[model samples]
Target chain A: MVNKAPLLEIKNLRVHYKVYGGVLKVLDGVNLTVYPGEKVGLVGETGCGKTTTMKTALAILPVPPGVVVGGEILYKGRNLLAMSPRQLSNVRGREMTMIFQDPMAALNPVFNVEQQFTPVLKHAAKNHLSNKEIHAQAVLALQDVALADPERLLQAYPIQLSGGMRQRVCIGMALATRPQLLIADEPGTALDVTIQAQVLRLLNNLVDRLNTSIILITHSLGVVYETVDRLYVMYAGNIVEVAPTRKLFSNPLHPYSQGLMDAVPKLSGGGISQGISGRIPDYSHPPAGCRFHTRCSHVMEICRHQKPPEFEVEEGHKVACYLYGPKNQEAAV
Target chain B: MSEAILEVRDLKKHFVVDHIGTFRRQPVTVRAVDGISFDLQAGETLGLVGESGSGKSTIAYILAGMYRPTQGRIHFRGLDLFSENGKRPLFLKKEIQIVFQDPGSSLNPRRTIAQNLAVPLQIHKPDKNIMRETLRLLELVDLPAIYMYKYPNMLSGGEKQIVAIARALATDPSFMILDEPTSALDVSVQGKVINLLMRLQSDLDLTYLFITHDLSLMRNIATRVAIMYLGKICEISKGSEFFQNPQHPYTQMLLSSIPVVSKDEEKLKPAKMIPTGEIPSPVNIPPGCSFNTRCPKKMDVCFEIDPDFVEISRQHFARCHLFGQTQKQG
Candidate 1:
């Protein structure tokens, strides 16, 4: 079934960082498309450039050490990469927002919740709203997030609230503007099991009502399993697979995706799970062909020399392994 | 039951915070670990599961001799841990060791892997060959012999934790307390650490008090699981039974909340059990049942009367009013 154009589209995103004397190829030829009101999860291990992918697409990458060597980040058919800083700033708070993993770190220690939230609300303000009007808006937003005593909570500093509460406050601040898209990076990772459940549900609920699309980046397969509709499996700065959440969990196509699924211990009291054997290769001197070929169990002769193209095995499902498509269609490899 | 390797009775560790603020200067009594008791049998893994404020970590700290309990008795093979002595008996200290959560902070960054291992070996087994023992420890954790010369910063998070575990085992402790060992690790690397820990447990015949917030982790590693909520063990059951048929409402919520790979995770909506908002501060825990504030099955009596522990089935116990009362005394 064909749908309208994606709300956000990224094509051939290549982000590089200058480390010491040489340039490090962080994100290489990444592609992602997110439709409006859809939930997409970006799952990867540490140093896989999940954060870099999001930051670069959002035009928020720090440029001295980092450089978007090549890429096209399109929002509503407009290229965000080419947008000026002033135009990008306008798009950030109102059009898109982000909720960090650590809410305490995102908030200021000395300032109360009121002071920290004002700047964000101001960016989202359509007209000249008074402090009282903004306070009312903040309280309503806080109440929407199921926080009790909104006025009283506003007077307190970030340190006084619990980790879950701090995150909820951050979520409230993010959704208060009613942005079209929200980017959450490990939003529930710092929370406890029960609290993580609360935060995720709240996020899902708030976004559902507002019809806000989400780009959730997390390492937990379980988090991605329950939360997102679709997800991208990343390895060493390369997106190995992209499929519907349920489909990926049941039958993960890529070898790295399967390895990651096998690594986490299950809750069903099963026998031990096997960990992926090798460490991720150094990105500075990344291996040729598939980034995960070194750790992949079904490594092929062609996999060592040629980079696999993202081949569509089924409708809406794409995999980068040479196990399908190019190797089958060409036979020359 | 097998002879209890370690026993804790009414363990309480309450810290009074002296408030220096101008408005409220009264010292607040934070009930970090309030009246909790559990026993660890030889060669068995007892998993203590809880959130941050649930005081599970505090119990680990007390057992490790990091903090002195305000009231309670911890018997290590029938020896009182808090005997008014500034120092613990060397035998007791050497026999019981604890591994902390953050391997990076727990390990000395300045020292090489060999130097770190040698510290414990020199203190307890000076007569033995230190370098040889260090090399053996490194091999046991699956690290190469070359890693002995490298520092902690050079190793990965999973490798660093493996080294931390090796250092903990240097003195050959029979009883070990693992405090959130794998929580900080990545999913794939976390599996390696858990596998190494299990192999070590069997090889050494060690008794463990494995504490973590990851309830799913207990399904494989823990022989017996103990669910802690607000400084109390809500339920203690075999790992298989614990997930199959959890007794406490709190345990059920935690289990259902786990993000499993299967679509079963979708069935467990957060609205099903877990209450909204953060865990109440330990400084002001609720009266009656600490969890009644959030318990979906909370009744009128739950607000006024606290529940006592009772064995519901063989090898399974729950601390909830749901099972009906036995007596006023626990």
Candidate 2:
């Protein structure tokens, strides 16, 4: 896996949203990578720019309000940001696709399943396939997601389907293109726990069988712990920690990561945790240096003034915190 | 043991909806709460756990007197709730207060925190100093008195929920119904709220009918846990036993399916029970067992007859043919 070239590489991605008072610096020099057939989890709370990063990667971020100040979203060694409209469209649904948190919003309420599938299928196939061929593929996709009756579902509207079924249809539609990479932003968050578990299992199986890479964005630590191999912990628009799922859980280096892990209520009975104190920083005037320094427990003087560089704590485990830097080590000694 | 603070017996709530798509305009009955029974002891948190459309919210509404039950009876401290008339007595209403999910909507956006808190205080404690009481409520929830002047929109999601909790506390009720209280908040914020609720439970000696879909959360907070499926209780047990020895197949399935953070927690989970199908519609629930369509260990009898609640242990009860038949044979 280390030797393999990354399927998607986001380098120094800086995104800003033009708001009323000032430009909200949503993504401040964010960096992430997804290797082929790798399951990566981007975990963060609300307004932490996890969704913004993914939306930017897919070129779906609404412009005028959203402006990419600086970034390079590289897919297969080619920069996605530099791609023309036609080129991006050709690569969008066919090569890489996204599934949103709300399936209802992603799907058209007026259109039946068949009508919804036709355009996506046609787009994926580059308009080469006939209507009948697309219909057959749609049925197969629906079956793959374990939706019982493909014929009945294809004729039904989005409103008619249950939340779980609607999500399944969305998953089926997203995977129908057989994209190399899939970005699922809280795909099962809206569904019930039982239904969420089922959907997640189905997603895992489908992605595994297809040998496709996935970037699962969710706030639930448990969900990420089970699904992803590697995790990128984002806090206030910065990738604060990046490590293997097990390693991150076992020995989290960053204060925010540790706080996040401790925040979740565990099933193995323990008293409720004292959750991280303070809210996410105001993005419009995000704290300088370490954005997490405002809430971090181990806040050094230099941390307040200087942005901490990503330090490799161990092999494949990186943390962006001054506590792990040379200054802290010398002080400790 | 202290007397049960609240008792529900054979409680049922059904809603009749117009079948719009069909040729004939026929109404379909959605059996939201189908003959569920439970007893909430004083100062004990009874966690009502279930999935969406499982009628957990309907049960909460019924208990809070927001909706009348289609059938059955509810007794609060030995006094029958429905014995009087359509309107609950003002004193009874004061005894039962509820905190709802989505505090953003629950707290009136137009009203300031002080005003919101004053509504319950003014209603329940009309003679008390409203200003002083509002500040006290704020202090109770760990928020500063300065926040009393702030509008709901000015406060964060967690702060708003705290305000809602304070409002619920305003009535000085012994029984509180928390309907998915912290589900809408962030994970980091959830802990603070849960800790506050737990602290308040001990401080106030409050009996909570906690309703939520997250079973893992109930493990830490609840004294007793009840699993609801399609408006019926499938299993009920002490909190420790609910996690350690989940009896019903549906319970086992729900337990196994929960995604745990650590391998140690994973080890404690029941063996993976892959649920087969999605939850059936409440309007068209399966003939026999509601969970039969999804239960992996379902037997032939599960499809033919609804099993009775078998007392698995001293206090643990499971409604499943697997246990029902075992008890019969024994």
Candidate 3:
């Protein structure tokens, strides 16, 4: 996948922060690639850099304390990290649109739907269009998310809408440009199960229709199973496992991945999925060797002393754990 | 079974809205728990299912002696719980407990898990050795004895929840109200907590007033379920029977809307009935059936007169006009 032409290739990405106490490594040597029209689910609990990874990719991350220390974000052969200010701006929103986790917070309270929708269209457009054309585009954008009476909704404020509707609006605004890649960070969390399903279905339908790639960052395995074809399981700012969704669920190689799967509440009658026992390691001074060793049920002595090299489990499945091979032992030696 | 542990008759708890408008103090009554009646068996888990502000929480709080009902009779062991002249029963306070939604909020932040769990013991059974009892409660919820000395902030969401459950059980309550106990927890943690609750129920012979919005989870654990909508019980039936063939339109819609992750199923089966729009404000409830505003098969009569609950099956009860007519005809 890395050898092939990727829609977005994140190679050895390292995002860090300079706090008063110390330098915090939030994203350490992360590697991921999404081919054209690929739906890759980035699954992890809170503070696992799932959100940070997406935000960094979009170049929208607030950066005074935060800094991308090293990385190559190659989108369509162009290295985004090396791009000029104008070049970066041109690619962002127009080429790869992003939707935030909380729609209510993301949307402006003072502005109506029409006000927010206009700027997005104007920004996406290479040349200025007529007011009629802009209004039509705005209505169409709302309709794209399946909002009833798009014209009426366009006139309404964000406060007038429900949480599900607000999320739909956010999705609509994101898709207004028809970007090559869509980065959704916990877009469906605020919604109810039914509404969440509707939003997810709408997203999938949009992606399919436009042939757009999507990076869905979620905490729920059920959502990942439903939405994504491939999954990247993160633990303590490190990519612990990367595999196809079915394979990851069926033959979870990493102990952390297994713990996550076992922790999720399943609809079917199986025993309780035991949750990961410990909290995510503090980023300012993360543990040596395997980042997940502290919580890993099958933690070996090598895991404590040495960082596990990426081991190829099977086709399209890779795991970072000492228990996997002698390569880890050799690294430790 | 054992003379009905708690018998609620026409339980109606309304909130008076004394908002100053153009007119003299506008007295708008929010009918939180509108005329409802049910009984809890000695050791049965009665699941109350509803979306936010469906008055499920209100009902639970009222039952737990937190709020006084405006109009109703809560007869617990032949004594009225809300009567003006009635003495508040000691058993109602001690023998009945609650586990709130957010374990973080329920447990004190400053206090250690041991201290937090020991509060109920100190309040109820003051004579008992509090530290010894706290360790036993912690063990009961599967929390390690070491966590007893740790503060609530030091614990994870799941651990805090375990501590909350331990505190609730400290008084050895025969009946408990678990209001969205697992809603705030992660899935795996939720499963563990639910399993713990199930085990505890069987072991302690506990009666539960389980309130939740998760239909799938309710089906797994609840013995009997009461579907609430806009401060009213749309339907109440045995869990098995309710899942098999729900009588009310709202109940059917709610059950169908649950996301099925099993690969055997394709296309999230949309609720056979999608209730139109959002729930109407309880403060300004519509005449007749409150659900009529969103109900798909609402009739003119449904808008004019309130529907009376009719027993469709042995234990299946619903408050739709369709069932009302069948009851009159039969």
Candidate 4:
């Protein structure tokens, strides 16, 4: 029987990388849930733990340097963090799949596309499928991504294909297994703009047709806006706010979110966009209270002292900032 | 109307590849920047945009006096660069500066931020009070006074980038070439750097040739833009007009391809993406339109002969047969 449950769920997950300096707290108390057929975006700047969160979901982070300090990552009711090495092999690509950033580096140069895709197909098979059967399925997967001549493409190495073509092949390989959850970490960052759009459309269609859940991690608010139904804004390894895409864009309560929105250069020939005032704080020794207080124009004394609780300002809209409190006026710059 | 600050005339850069040993082969000349010309007006930001190895940066380096052009003339302030008439002016060396893409490598890790800032001042005006000027430059880039003592390794990517910019501004150059200056930065920090660049440009009355692959950011910052392909420009226009009505098929694809935050109602239907093909080597570039290999709207003429860039509307230009044919039909 097909199991019916939330595709994946994370509760108070914290991932830290132990560098020579100290324990770098990359992901601090990250809580997320992905229901089937939902596409959510994890938006943040570089080194904000967006990639780490996705890597942890698939148990891909190397253990020697990186460690999951606490919390649970439940995929189909199974604790992925607690899974043994042997058991994890079964669920990794079959139940949860990931498309990494940097398509060029993600693919191996020596292996052809066929060699890379065959193992996933073999792992998912109920009974032993023939080579012909696998080839047919592979062609269809390539075609789904709008890659013409999939039959010939199967024989080409990753080096032979263009950056966009390689990314399409990677997406096709990931989707071939019909994964319950697809976590794409900046899948379109490296491609040319036109090719990037094509990939986004393909991803959108795949999520719909397969009824697959996806978690898209990117630094681009624009990318998040186009593909995600909801967004979780991460700042300095913390989830500062979570809201529906429309609500977040329309009225961003968090100062960081508002700053990010304002930074987007409007195509209407507006003069210089105002950037966020300060840099991302050092993760090893993050500031007290709200991490954003260092740059927030409407910062309060309380913001520098005590961390604000996540408050539900509206239905499906949550913000973590002291400015939204009952006594304070909603400030804008 | 603004006066042109820098002008490039039919600039071309060709690198000849030699395959030595056994097989005696013909030398291949990589047409990195092939016959491109444009004018940069004073106090205006002109964005040069293209994908990886699209020759956008090549044009930038050429304009910055870093790379000598294989053929063509570059004029700064109506003075011919590298002239034989004793016109080898000092301003050519001091007036133009560059802020490169990667701060990690661009900055010397061994030296302090203040020391890096001192290098330019020493090169241009050594007799002045270097320490005071260095601190002032740091303040202009929005760095704390304390950061002058810190090394590049001690600072963040954003901080290091600020130091690089501060150093570039030390000589008080009239023109700057920022090549992917913020691409390495976080979005939050990227915004800050972009804002800083704009502020400096206005305050100093500087001219910029901004090179990047980010369409949205370029749309935000650039006053005018040139869409580059393999060693050639596919389109050029005033920024807002180009974004609003992109005539070149490649430009349309580039703009529409960017995923953006949108209200639910405004989301466009998924556009038909151009097909992917190898970015044919510059060494042996295809005849006619360089974008035709990957262009979805490619016609028979696109592969046979290069199309002439015509003014479709005020200040807007496109180098595509489709636009050319449409003009003729009209």
Highest DockQ against the true fold, candidate: 2
Once superposed on the true structure, which residue ranges of model 4 sit more than 4 Å away at CA?
A1-5, A324-333, B18-23, B82-90, B263-281, B323-330
Model 4 lDDT, full chain set: 0.83
Residue pairs clashing in model 1 are none
| Model 4: per-residue Cα lDDT over A69-144, one tens digit each | 9999998788998889879988887777889888989888999988877887888774387899889889998998
Q: Candidate 1, residues A223-298: lDDT per residue as tens digits?
A: 8888899999988888889999989888898988888888877765565676887788877889998888889888
Clashing pairs in 4: A222-B259, A222-B260, A222-B261
Give the per-residue lDDT digits (tens) of candidate 1, residues B123-241: 99989999999988988888899998999999888999999999999989999999999888888888888989999999999999999998778878898999998888889988878
Model 2 misplacement above 4 A: B19-26
Candidate DockQ values, in order, are 0.63, 0.77, 0.37, 0.51
lDDT minimum window of 10 residues, candidate 4 chain B: B262-271
**Candidate 3 or 4, higher lDDT?**
3
In terms of TM-score, which candidate is strongest? 2
Docking verdict class for candidate 3: acceptable
Worst 10 residues of 2 chain B by lDDT: B18-27
Q: Compared with the true structure, what per-residue lDDT tens digits does model 2 show for residues A180-264?
A: 9999999999988888988999999999999999999999999999999999999988899999999999999899989888888
Worst 10 residues of 4 chain A by lDDT: A265-274
Residue A65 in model 4: lDDT: 85
Task: Report the candidate with higher lDDT, 2 versus 4.
Answer: 2
Query: Evaluated with lDDT, which candidate comes out highest?
Result: 2
User: Whose lDDT is higher: candidate 1's or candidate 2's?
Assistant: 2
Off by over 4 Å in 1: A328-333, B19-27, B264-271, B326-330
Model 4 per-residue lDDT tens digits across residues B90-182 = 667789899999999999889988888898898788799999999899888888899989999998788888889999999899999999998
The residue-by-residue lDDT of candidate 2 on B1-330, one tens digit each, is 889978899999989986655685777899999989889999999999999999999998988889988899999998888764578888899899899999999998899999999998888899999999988898899998899889999888999999999999998899999999999999898999999999999999999999998887898899999999999999999999889998889888888888899987998877767755788999899989988888878789989999998898989998999888877888
Better of 1 and 3 by lDDT: 1
